[model samples]
Target: MAVEELVGPAPKGWKYKTLGEACKDGGGDIQTGPFGSQLHASDYVPVGVPSIMPQNIGDNRIIEDGIARITPEDARRLSRYLVRRGDIVYSRRGNVERRALVGHHEDGWLCGTGCIRVRLGENGADPRYASYYLGHPVVREWIVRHAHGATMPNLNTSILAACPFLEPPLAEQRAIAHILGTLDDKIELNRKQNETLEAMARALFKAWFVDFEPVRAKMEGRWRRGENLPGLPAHLYDLFPDRLVESELGEIPEGWEVISVDTEFDITMGQSPPGSTYNDIGEGLPFYQGRADFEFRFPKRRVFCTAPTRLAKIGDTLVSVRAPVGDINMALEDCAIGRGVAAVRHKTGSRSYTYHFMSSISDVFARFDAEGTVFGSIGKKDFHSISHIKPPRDLVLTYEKLAANLDDEVEKNEQESRTLAALRDNLLPKLISGELRVKDAEAFLKERGL
Candidate 1:
């Protein structure tokens, strides 16, 4: 496609540039990672400098957890591959479009064995501008066409350097970056805040239900029969029986009971719609095949079905039943599903507790049901029989009230991120191509209070 048709034409003073020319003009450098031999698996250490590989890149940032690390000495040995703040790292294989800019938090980290790093020169383009440019849809399509290795799709410096670029004036470039970056900063803050809120919810769930904190307190004489616990009000604390009872599963708080999944909640084993009924343009309801569609606690919009054979209500817990099973996501709205997933709703109307409880136990399903080389699945009979201790109804209701606000906030933050991302995508090409002037963009940002 012609660049103008795709990204809109630039204004009078703007100039066309290739990635290589822009970088050469700006004093930028681009290189892929050292080969495996240069950064050996054996060189990695338990606790030291991190080596950022493709997997560490997520949500436009590095995911530090589970990433490999190497000793400080080894990091020094690979100093040439080190990433600095303001550099952008791209996955060199499998997914050429995925990239993350190195922020202050990632400064001086090793750009691990299967990635590429680009350091912008001080003069050519704003680092943030170039990073956002790389993520823009028009530029992404250009990069896709230039990518080598059709089998898995790969990126090399030569191919990347030759890709097309649009060069607006440096001042306009910074303005565009500022507008987009403000949205990104807010989105990231929401993500971190949601993480903290979810952690707090889980901690509260663990304390009240799994650990039986109230029962333990009475056992240790830390609580009196009629007194309120330190954190809970007297009426709420009174819901927990101040003793333990032996059940088939284990010692549960008094008045709680061991129960099978079906007895305590509702389960809908998904049924696939007829193949012809599937659509991509949101024909009817949002559709999901399995946990692969999940994004954090919610699922991505992948497909839809004109004729849905099974449905999930909003807030219901969705569980993957096929291979790589037990992954869970909550329904953000009523949606359609295929056989690889199941929808679960609590009978007591406390969906948040059902979500948290199912997540806590999904591991049990994943372990026992794994089979087949590619499509391991659990049967409906086996799923219904999965058992667990149920906290007394009143306590569960109370916990739901305590947890609902947090869950609602998480959903709201996710929705807000989606809206911001849409706005970014809409403005990206216009801003980069100068169809929207810097002053206009700045006005939009100000009006949005960015």
Candidate 2:
């Protein structure tokens, strides 16, 4: 495919070259990662230098969780595959368009089997700028179109080396990267803050409802009237019963009762609409099939249905009820859900309580996945059969009052991040292609105090 056909001709003073030409012009080279024959599965160790694989690649970043590691000796043996700061890495197969830019923290890490490494020459293009340019929708589409293989798309050094590279003056590249990076930095900060806030809410749930900490403290005499202890205040000591009693779920606060999930929340199992009704372009409501549509706390809108069979109202907790069950997200707005998902909401309309409570019961959902046929699933009967201890309405309301503030703050940050992301995406192609000058972009950001 012609590069100009996808991105149009490069602006004046800009040059378009194959990635290999650009790399060689500087001094760098494109290379494939260590072959499977060179590094076997047995070489992986519990703790040592990380070995980046296809799964470790995220949106221009390396995700470290569940990353395989190799011993220092093995890493030394595969030294040629070590990635350095400014180096770009791509998966060799599947999701061929995804790539990540190496950072200082990942210097010396091995580019493991089924991956490719691209190191730009020192005198060549700005790596950050190149990284962003490669992530542009047009570039990604080009890569996807060219990748080889029938079952799974595959990539190699030759494929990547021949990909088009658009170069601007080094200074202009830096400016563009800086503008985009600033928005990304803010989005990352919001993501981390949301993680912390979610953890805090989970911990509070475990302490108050799951562990019965306050009641236990009162029973043990560690809590006293008009005296404060960590996380439990003196004024709130009276909210929890002072004694523990035997119940179906074992020892519990005296007044608490065990109730089925359906008794506490309204459940709406989804029904998929006809395939002909689905479209990528916005037509009606956003449609979510299952866990695949989930993000940190909300479902991303990818599919829309002109005729939605089932609907989930805004703020309802969406739970995956098929295959690998119970992954959760909340409906940010009223949307359509497919058969794999179930929408849940507290009968009292406490979204905060509903989300946290569902999150705290992974074990309950795990059973469904383990016991069913080849592919696990949970019907409404099985879903509603799971029981939970019911605290007093006043206590549930009190927890909701406190947790809702934190949830609200999380939502505010998420909204700001979304707006910033939209602005960044809108500016990227224009800035990279020189349609929008750096100074003009800078002035726009300054006006917004960005």
Candidate 3:
């Protein structure tokens, strides 16, 4: 297909060239260093210079969260390997070759061994253009073909230097980058907003349940022998009379009770069929793994099986029971989960309340997880031993009312984010291929008022 057919028309004075010809040198320079053993977790205090690793470089993006840091002494030990702003970093030793271009935001970051950092020549190649080109399908295929090693495929400095691109003029490069960056900015905003909302809900839960502020207020009224408080309903009064109860776990509020997880809910482990049983015909049902199934978007890639033993209905909570503890998500459709996950169905009450309660207790379960050097897992026995603070029927009803409203708002924001992500992914390939021009993209954005 012609480029004009996808986008409107190319700008005047634009010249097309191969990426190698556009650069003064054949390709950018790569720097290597000693592995990450020089630093330890104790050496990493709260705030210091970031230490970039292969895991830090996401597919076509940079992840600033869950990063490690080092002290001045550690920095001095690895001084030669520090990366500057606008350096492109790529993973050299992994089955999936992850890559990301550094931005001006990360000016003086220290890089790890698993990545090969690239510095452009004096001709001033656009870093954003290089980033987009590296992420293109053709370039990735080329890297895979040239990758060396049997157990773990890898790319070295030489392979990365030879990766090709369809180079456009500098102005067009900047325009393409700017358009893509704008979409990313929106996605980042949605993520931050959702985090804030989730924090607010958790804070409210802490205030009322953990700190017992509401119970304290009620007790103060009873101690002074005064009338009921203004905000509290009449039935809630005298609910927390001066009393302490002992249980299997420990002392709890007077009226509160303890119960096993199975008593209140029906839980079952998921099963993964053998490789021969797996099919991508899109005929039977959706299949899922642990955390991959819980991504913000609904599962687009699906596997199917005719077996009845591997099915879970919508609204059932899918909890990761293995390696990573308590990664929970509610199913959006009838699906089958791998062995790493378990499905929970609430007994009779509102599933919303159960979901929130499980989320609240997730941290406690994580603590009881069996520790190991390589992998840690939480077994069913440990999960069954978890103690829960079961509130009275009226309080649970109150929690349900408040939580449902907040959850509705969260779901609305999630849906909008999904739509924006789809649009962004659809436009990225076309724009980078020169099949879609900047003017057409701008017009499309204007029509949507974005």
Model number with the top TM-score: 2
Q: Write the per-residue lDDT of candidate 3 for residues 32-131, one digit (tens) a residue.
A: 5446576655677668888777778875566788787777777888887787777777777874456777777776788776777777655656777667
Q: Which structure is stronger by TM-score: 2 or 3?
A: 2
Query: Could you estimate the TM-score for every candidate?
Result: 0.91, 0.92, 0.81
Candidate lDDT scores, in order, read 0.84, 0.89, 0.67
lDDT of 1 by residue, 35-153 (tens): 98887778888899988999888756788878899999888888999998888888888777878988998899999898988877777688888888888887787777778885888
Q: Model 3: how far is 57 from its true place, Å?
A: 3.0
| Candidate achieving higher TM-score, 1 or 3 | 1
Every candidate's CA RMSD: 2.7, 2.4, 4.9
Residue pairs with colliding backbones in model 2 are: none
State how far residue 93 of model 3 sits from its true place (Å).
2.7
Which has the greatest lDDT? 2
The regions of model 3 sitting more than 4 angstroms off are: 1-28, 37-47, 101-105, 120-123, 217-244, 296-308, 348-352, 367-374
